[model samples]
Target: SMAQDAINRVLVDRAREGKFVVRLKGGDPFLYGRGYEEAHACAEAGIPCTVVPGVSSALSVPALAGIPVSNRGMTHEVTIVSGHLPPGHPGSLVDWEALARMRGTLVVLMGVKNSPAIADSLMAGGRSPETPAAIIVDGSLDGQVTHRCTVGTMATTLTDRGVRPPAIVVVGEVAGLPQVLTRA
Candidate 1:
């Protein structure tokens, strides 16, 4: 977390110097990137910090791969979760069981390394093993790769494909949406 600490310090220092500082980040900063911490630091120093909204990979990545996180009459809810913490970790706040019961799209970020445990937790928590799943690597950029599989085989499929971080994992019916309909 040293890098983040350094970032916060820089933001505070620049704001204190009465300079406008823009901390550009990939996706929505607040999603899981600790944008709030930086904002809080600025506030504590009585500095003005304006937030500019940006696209999040949770939605954009899937769309780029011709997968919609939600579709009319197909799915109305979408849940985005951080896979940074493995299931059952003491510090983890995500309710895997509840997420498992949700009948909607589940988009997981930074979960590539822990996909097996995540998939296991979902299935154990009542999610169907056959649920359609997809992994979009290096999404929204050139050299992006999309791999489709069932929840039961998601981890193995990712491994077989040599999938890595900076990927989005979409689960549910939406992941299996017809390609023809999604083509722009």
Candidate 2:
């Protein structure tokens, strides 16, 4: 968190110096990047801060892997969540059971480490084991690798493929649509 502290300090300093400072970050700064903390700090210091929107990996990653989050009548809703915490962890705010029951695309960010537990929770919560799932590593980059499987086998597939962090996990019918889409 020191990095974020440093960033906030710099923003405050630059604003006090009457200089316009733009904070550039990967994906959308507001999503899991603590962009609001910096904005709040700037405002408290009487600095005017402006936010320029950017594409979030939740949308871009699946798209890069040729998986649309919402496809016509297939799905109209998408729920994006952070997978940083295990399902039962006291610090976790995500309700795995609720998510499992949701009939929509599920996009999980930073959840690779706890994927096994997450999958188990989803299945135990009544999500079909055969539900389509995908893990997109290095998404939207030249080194991107997309692994397709069912929710029942997602963890094993990721382990077998040596999939690591900084990846996106997509689940639901939309996840399987890539097979039907014509690839260019």
Candidate 3:
């Protein structure tokens, strides 16, 4: 809930003072991390800032749980969206209906609180209620848990499993792929 502009000011101020600053952010900054925005702010303030790409949990979390986003004939697409704002929210631009119609994996970031709404919208948009679903909580950290269920039971599974923020939700056939498609 921190303001980007507020942090931008500090970055600019420190750069002006010739203080070398390194902003370490988990995951790829451009992948809904607002890292580009920070770089833009630095550029606008005439500060020389560089953004180093990092691994994104949207892709890594599922992989950590042995879910390949795309495999030969498994799926040809992988869609990642932020569930920070539930579907239908004025601030949300995600088209849950269109996503529901797509064939591939759907990964949601920061969607713990809106899992219910998200599942409901996808089902209402024509996605099968029995569609496979999984939530990788506390991804890449100690005690990480991968909760499995169907899209229909996502809401309940999340609650029953005690899923929380900083989790990645995977919906589609890929969610059920808990084993490496191949080891070669």
TM-score of every prediction relative to native: 0.94, 0.94, 0.94
lDDT of 1 by residue, 12-51 (tens): 8987787888898888888987889989988887887888
Q: Who wins the lDDT comparison? A: 2
- lDDT for model 3 comes to 0.88
- Model 2: per-residue Cα lDDT over 43-64, one tens digit each: 9998888988789999988887
How big is the positional error of residue 170 in model 1, measured in Å on the Cα after superposition?
A: 0.3
lDDT of 3 by residue, 70-157 (tens): 8789899999998999999999999999999998999999898998999999999999999999888888887777888999999899
TM-score of 3: 0.94
Q: Give Cα distance to truth, residue 81, candidate 2, Å.
A: 0.2
